[model samples]
Target chain A: MTGTASRPTLEAVAARAGVSRATASRVVNGGDGVREPLVERVRRAVEELGYVPNQAARSLVTRRHDAVAVVIAEPETRVFADPFFALQLRGISKELTAHDSQLVLLLTEGRDDHVRVGRYLAGGHVDGALVFSLHLDDPLPGLIHGAGVPTVFGGRPGWGDGPRDAVPTVYVDCDNRGGARDAVRHLVGLGRTRIAHITGPLDQTSAADRLDGFRDVMVDVDPALIAEGDFTPAGGERAMRELLERRPDVDAVFAANDLSAAGALRVLRERGRRVPDDVAVIGFDDMLPVAEQTDPPLTTVRQDIEEIGRLMARLLLRRLDRAADEGPVGAPSSVVLPTTLVRRASA
Target chain B: MTGTASRPTLEAVAARAGVSRATASRVVNGGDGVREPLVERVRRAVEELGYVPNQAARSLVTRRHDAVAVVIAEPETRVFADPFFALQLRGISKELTAHDSQLVLLLTEGRDDHVRVGRYLAGGHVDGALVFSLHLDDPLPGLIHGAGVPTVFGGRPGWGDGPRDAVPTVYVDCDNRGGARDAVRHLVGLGRTRIAHITGPLDQTSAADRLDGFRDVMVDVDPALIAEGDFTPAGGERAMRELLERRPDVDAVFAANDLSAAGALRVLRERGRRVPDDVAVIGFDDMLPVAEQTDPPLTTVRQDIEEIGRLMARLLLRRLDRAADEGPVGAPSSVVLPTTLVRRASA
Candidate 1:
């Protein structure tokens, strides 16, 4: 049962208002140049008939959809298995709602979905896009660039070689490097010299930046102390086990995220090690439920993930608004919010 | 720079392919009635010029955008702050991706957002919608129904008083009643008659159905043993505290969800009650991360949340496909998936 078939049309509205078709059309399209009396009559008719102007028809004239597409390229289910992306989405949703814009979510699982996302963007549906391209080797950046849609990235996107390889684009990122450094620094301050690092998947820029931050603090630390994790609790358990086998004397660990840290803690407990006595622990991304609920509450670095999402939307919306006012909008500057270390019992 | 302004038009493609504009247009719009040689030439010319047929123009002819909107209306931060919604989304995303449909996310925080979402759905941007309205008093159902979009609800929707008040609709849900019965039966087998129940917000049909299931097992149970929880660990903690005060002899607790169970477990520990030895605990939803990570793992009822999401999309997609073929489609049937009892340390 399609109610749209019975929806009143422009002709019906004009008939009900006792106005010319041209007058009704003009009033419906923002009442520009139309007098108050005719506009009022048309508005009353629209209200009575409950005639919603089809956006498809409106976009044909204005060439704008008043909607933004949010493309999230998370191939691994690990990312969605946690609350990280959910919090970011909440923030983005709130900001978009405030701007009176709709959010069209385009989630890509892998390479095939990437092409689907690319085609959708190129289809000229939404006003702009907000993309989260975490992995270094991801082709999404190049595809979105080629689509030529105005887009703002969620994290600091990594391209060819170095950070400078990042194309000049508007993005919002937390101080991942700074946060990681603080976590390690706090561990070191607690007299933990044999500090081991469990990194997230290095393909992601956040994980890479976090590892870099760890290395910056532990400059002369043993290479055997470092191991890779895929930003999952299980991965953290495996990496932590490997680090313990390689360097049994390791007294402290800095995990890339709270989930990984929880895993590491579990491993340490099973091995009959006393937290803060035998081993000190620190984690990044002070995820509250995970951090506070741990056996021995975790001391970690805090990054306002929701804030990062809100800022990303704000940046993209500003660009869209500026573009609407005139041609040749300047490239908006990227933002990196500061991170602070949250002290707890573990470290 | 506007890529669309410089985008190659049908006239340019026709010129390059040595054909008329009408011929090029026909080829681009699925090449029906056009000869193979001309279609091939036009396609090559279009590819070489990187021409993307405007969807805004195309939708006018097809009257379909091939996009689906997913409206998640949860005002509280607790829902989005956990992995529950994330798993459902992953399931929804995978299903929608398989069908080659885009997901437009509409998250509403308050009453204002409900109106905004109502208007957006009425605007007819997407072909159909998958809505999650967890609360009974929520006006979203009425609004979405008024919008007249083909929709499939996430759970068994609760209208005013009777089940008959529910508008005839397609929906997907887990067997909450069966799952709860299994949980209570397990506790009864353990010889725990004074079992307390921590329920999720009763305004939701899932919570109400779960309570009904609990009553199904314990006919002579005390009414004071049941306490309302909002499906958060914090809510669980509060409910557990209230239950302990009312009936300190309570030998078992059945939390409506894992997060609430985790909270109840924490309260039990704080009150010096050893799990299983003093008070056994069982939770619903069996969320892996929370259940396994708890001090002693939680025995609970398992619902395939992702499958619920997948089925919801399948039901809506089938309706949309059928609607395209002809006359008034029949009332689509709702689905209720089976749940299993996942045994763990707590019970």
Candidate 2:
């Protein structure tokens, strides 16, 4: 049955409160310039009648929906299986809840969804957006920019070529380069003589930055020590296998992420090598499930994935607030939060 | 600056198309009773003008929003850290996408959030809601019910004492009891006489049913062989520790879920017990990351988690469709999907 048709009306509330319709309307709209006694009476009447304000009616006047779209442009299963994105969502959800804003999730499988999403954003269903454009080739940033919604991105938007659009993007990301350097430095401090590196799908900026950080630490090291991975356990397993074959004397490995590092750990265990004795392993993104549950537990780079989500919301909210108050929104400065190395049994 | 104010209006499209305002209105609002040629002309003008229909205004007339709210009642970190919820969301997203509906996520932290969500559902912001209330005392189910929104619950709801509400709820849940029985039967077939059982949080129906399933197979089993687990890795580790201490010679263990199974495996390894040799182990849910990544993998019950989410959306969509077409919508049937035993190395 349609409850919408049976909901209590504003007239009923005014009648029950024994106030004029205009006074009741003013109190209900937000009690602006209305007496406290009338506001309380109307509020009590609303509660008793179970009257819910029609959002559609209010939104027409306010041009604000108190909702934000969160666009995740990854078709990968990692978006569902991995803890990385989930933590970020938790953070985003918390921030939005604080601001009394709803989170409209738009999960795009591919290009067609991008067009649909672009149209939806341009449709003005929500106030603004929080986008996660994970890959360099992901066209979401450009599409969203064209849609002209006030947006804060989860990570820095980088195209394969030069800047795709002239618009400045505001984003919050962890310091992948700095985090990778800390991981390698820790391994080096432990006196690992033959250190190897596992690279993620180099297309992603985070993975690319991490590889660069590894290169920064191991200048002039044998190229044979570097193995390519795709930020997956199977990829990590294959890369670890390849690295062992290429450099059998390798004493340590810095994996691109925890999932890959978990796979490397499995390989090390299967190969009859004692961790931290025969081979020390460190990973990026200290995802608790993988990091704490690993056999020897993982020593990995700690990036506050949730904080990135929270900061992204905070920045977007500020942009929305400023724009609501005055004119054009000034380009908010982007931020890269620092990372720390978490020591565990592996190293 | 605000693009909402600068957006192309319906009047602009009408003027640009060289048509009457009524003709353009017909074309923009689903092209009902409009000529094909005029509809084509109006569509072109709309595209050229980059016009987007204002959702608030449209909703005021149509009383229909092609949007669905996904309310996850768990304030626990599991909603974020566990792959269970994520997989469900992915399934819900896919189905909703196919139906041209937006997925609005509402993650509640506690009691106050329950009140907020109840109000939001009553506000008629979304067409319907897919709710996940993990615990019996969650209060979300009762609140959402009173809110009078069209709802389909993620799992079968059971109050601690008697039926909490008069409304017959429609839900989508896997055969948890059957799955548990299958797991126990498999362990029994393995010739493990002294089998231990680990239960999830008993307050929930799924966990309670699982414990009953274990009993359906292991009648008259020693009380010491059964241990309580909270469906977490730490809880699993603790339960296994207690079980091993009470019955060291327990030849097999059946955990409530893969998380606890992984935790149990950790304790078994640390205590120098070889898997499948010293103590054969089985878990439920067959969650890929936990099941496949664990040492020796895990033989467990496989429930179609994504299908549950997809089916929930299907049921709600069907309900919405019926309500739109008819006067009073009939109650849609609740569904219980089948589960199968996934054999892996642990058992």
* C-alpha TM-score for every candidate: 0.78, 0.74
Shares of reference contacts reproduced by the candidates, in order, are 0.23, 0.14
Docking class for candidate 2: incorrect
Candidate achieving the largest lDDT: 2
Instruction: Give per-residue lDDT, candidate 2, residue B218.
Output: 94
lDDT of 2 at A318: 87
- For candidate 2, the TM-score is 0.74
The pairs that clash in candidate 2 are: none
In angstroms, what RMSD does candidate 1 have relative to the true structure? Answer: 6.6
Q: Please, what are the lDDT tens digits per residue for candidate 2 over residues B54-135?
A: 6656676876778788988776356766778888988888898888777777665554566556556765667889987558
> What lDDT tens digits, residue by residue, belong to model 2 across residues A64-130?
7777888887753556666777888889878988987776676655544564566667656678999
What is the interface root-mean-square deviation of candidate 1? 4.4
Candidate topping DockQ: 1
lDDT of 1 by residue, B178-215 (tens): 99999999999999989999999998899999999999
